[model samples]
Target: MPEARAPVHVDGEVVASKRIGGYRHLTLTAPGVPERFRAGNFVAVSVAGHVTRRTLWVHRVRASSAFGPTLDVVVEARGSGTAWLTAQPVGAKVAITGPLGRAFALPKEAVSCLLVGEGYAAAPLFPLAERLRERGCAVSLVVSAPDEARLLSALEARRSARSVTVLTADGSVGQRGTVGDHVDDLVRRSEADVVYAAGPSHVLRAAAGAAERVGAWSQVAVETSMPCGTGLCHGCPLPVVGEDGVDRVVRACTEGPVVRGDRVRWDDL
Candidate 1:
């Protein structure tokens, strides 16, 4: 892990915002957030009239864009908080606190990697793929959604992964199926040593199990209701079996968001 940096609270200006497929993508001029960001780190954005801040995974970070340093996040406007974020104008200001939570651990060896992503939460994996490729790791990506518009860009995914597999539930685009139906086969084909996944709970659960069956290490980025991005709220509890053989609950905002797939109490969640 890169040297950790303290989270900073800043009033950031929305540099760009657009609709990408079925998601809302935004770029914010967050001065210190991008400088300290790691692949799995996320930002907590203050909602206009809500006391609760929305936690969004930092999709991509730009050290310098036309608007200066910026970071991107993809949001699904399924709730009031997210809806407000997507509605922000270019010049609108939003309060952001980041680069928070534990990051996905990278491997020391140049081993083959398999990345599984579903929906907008797949946002973080794009950067992870770049980092893995930089280390000369062979990366295979599996992107899935219910339909074409819900899937992340396969064109962009191809640039990072050695291979890209697209799956859709309704067959509106790629393969007609869900991750559970095809992941085991993909893992066997890639012979991946490590599997990294991000997305909905069901997707993560399925990916984790497939990786385990293939004897591959698995790390999953989980999405939960994080009322506050900081650990102070103790609102986002994740049940896990600690290394000490103890079953405990940890704050997703602090201890995780990224955790060993096997250790999670998936049945409980």
Candidate 2:
């Protein structure tokens, strides 16, 4: 594992921005971000440098001499903060603090890994696929969305994983069904030893359940509203089952955004 650097506040310039289907992909040129960034880590952008900030998961990181390092994030303009973010033009400046929160812990041995994601939630998993492949793991992906137009990073997933399966609710894409509907079959077909997922609570619950059915270890990145990216706000707490079988609330910003799927109290989610 690489050492994690302290978080820093930096002014980043939007080097590139593109509208991909229903999401906006932005590449920001900022010094010292790439080296500190890890797959599954996120950045909190202070929209317009105002008090209002939105937390976004990192999609990719790269090196750049022009700006030192670059960070990428996929934004869905569902709210005012994201609307403002996606509307920024190239060369626009934004304040950001990151590589925040715990990252996915890759399995030590080379094992078949199944990654499941939905819509924009798939943003972080591509980077994770790169790391898993580097570790000699055979990676497969199951990406789900409402329709073909909403499938996030399908090309990227195909490029990164050994195999890719897509699912859509309206049958406008690869298959007609929710990811949960095919998770068990996918897990068995992939011969996956571990499952990693990020999406809505219900989807994650189904993914976890499917993994359990196959006797595979499951790691999940949970989604929640983060008013403060740091743990102080206590706004992103989720119920988790402790070793003693007691349910306790843990802040996603501190303890995890990635947690053991079996340890999470899915019913409480």
TM-score, one value per model? 0.98, 0.95
> For residues 43-148, what per-residue lDDT tens digits would candidate 1 score against the true structure?
9999988989999988889988898889989998998999999999999999999999989899999999999999888989999999999999999999999988
Question: What Cα-based lDDT does every candidate model obtain?
Answer: 0.91, 0.86
Clashes of each: 0, 0
Cα lDDT of model 2 by residue, 9-37, tens digit: 78888999999888899998766667787
Locate the minimum summed-lDDT window of 10 residues in model 2: 1-10
* Model 1 regions more than 4 Å off: 1-4
Stretches > 4 Å off in candidate 2: 1-5
Who wins the TM-score comparison? 1
Q: State how far residue 139 of model 2 sits from its true place (Å).
A: 0.3
- Model 2 Cα shift for residue 82 (angstroms): 0.6
